[model samples]
Target: MPYDPPPELAGLSLAQIAEQVAARNLPPLDTWDPPETEHSGMRITADGRWFHRDSPITRPAMVRAFASLLRREDDGRYFLVTPHHKQAIDVEDAAFIAVDCKADGDALAFRLNTDELVLAGPHNPLRAQGDADTPAIYLSVRHGCEARLDRSTWLQLADIALADGGDLSVGSQGATFALRPA
Candidate 1:
């Protein structure tokens, strides 16, 4: 066995888990060396919806808990890892969605669908995929994971870009993203 959280911790509500995550005292996921397990047959859609066996997972807390355990390897595999298991999961586009954002001066902070925060720039550099006609934006989260920017969040970033000489080189904590015009 690896380093699993106490069984009691799994019984806590998502909010309680969030507090622990915020406090940064949860299980050390990166350090866990669990054996690889079979694919979980789960997929996270581009919009951040999760599906298991082609059925949507309706529980918000379940989704959040799974999201917390998500990890992406350099080989391009996504896994929902625990101390006891490293179950592969499919990601159609991205593992997370950035739905909202705030710009405090030049620093930018994005709120992901997973209820996690991603600060734009430097270590979390924002980037774009696709092309000018249909740009797919993404923000790198820690641990080699990323969150795709949802439409509304993209628009917010675009607005900031327009205000700043048609570019998004301004973000929270002095982070900068460059968004070229379509």
Candidate 2:
């Protein structure tokens, strides 16, 4: 089956987006602590492209499946883990990219390149770093993994912050996040 990306964020209500988020059933990567470790030779580029042994993994399903198994250790290394095996994968920047985002009520939702929905809140906090001249924003995905917001998505988020109060900040789930690092 072909992968169908979710509809535009602007068209969906917060409740609907939340429902979709709740419906997702990702692998329990945390519980699976495989004793054996190996190298997967897979790398996720800074631009969110997945490659294996210098070949692009073009299949969305395969990419999504691999993404679901991803786990980042405290030392900042990424691995695809199972109950019996753990394999390393290199990440140039973030593990995923926030391809799109939307602001609904007091919450913000982001859709990743892997078709994963992330609702920015206490658990999934947004962080902005770098200087005013070149700022980078990221959202926590899961298991110590983060997603870098794409250019367009960052612009959308900027617009939202401006419209809210022009303070270069946005509030979600009772937390206020500065769009740029202070």
Candidate 3:
């Protein structure tokens, strides 16, 4: 089946976005600590491309399925977890890419390359790093995973920040986020 992207963030209300986020039923990666471990030889590029043995994984469904099983350990390692086994995967940068973003009322919604919907809030905050010359923005996805905003999505969030104030900050879910270095 072909992957159908979600409707644009602009058209969705905060409640609607929350509904979509809640609708996703993921595996219990946190509880499933399988005794078996292996290296899957899968890697996620900085730009959100999934590769195995250096060849791109072209199927969207496969990518999405793998992404759902991804978990980041406290030691900064990523793994694709199943009930029976946990396989290591290399991540060039973030595990996912925020390909699209929009400001909805007091909330900010983002769509990942895997078509996952994330709402920026207290739980899933946005973090800005790097210096003025080279800036990078990331949104916390879940289970210690983050999504780096792509160029256009970063620009869209920047515009929203500037529209709100000169502080280069935006508020969502009763929390404020700075778009630039302090």
TM-score of each predicted structure versus truth:
0.81, 0.96, 0.95
The number of clashing residue pairs in model 2 is 0
What are the per-model C-alpha RMSD values against the true structure?
Answer: 7.4, 1.2, 1.3
Candidate 2 lDDT over residue span 1-182, tens digit each: 76677787778899989998998888898889887567898999999999999999999999999999999999999999887899999999999999998888899999999988899989999999888888999999999999999999999999999999998998888988999977
Pairs clashing within candidate 1: 106-171, 107-171, 107-172, 107-173, 108-171, 108-172
lDDT scores of the candidates, listed in order: 0.75, 0.92, 0.91
Q: Candidate 1 lDDT, tens digit per residue, 1-182? A: 33333234225444454454466533467898799989999999877899999999987778877887889988999998898999999998888888877664556667777666556768788887788888888888866789988888889878877787764555545555566433
Candidate 3 lDDT, 47-166, residue by residue in tens? 889999999999899999999999999999999999999999999999999999988888999999998999899999999999987789999999899999999999899899888986
- Off-target runs (Cα >4 Å) in candidate 2 are none
Q: Which ranges in model 1 have alpha carbons more than 4 Å from their true place?
A: 1-26
lDDT of model 1 at position 169: 51
Q: Candidate 1 or 2, higher lDDT?
A: 2
TM-score of 1: 0.81
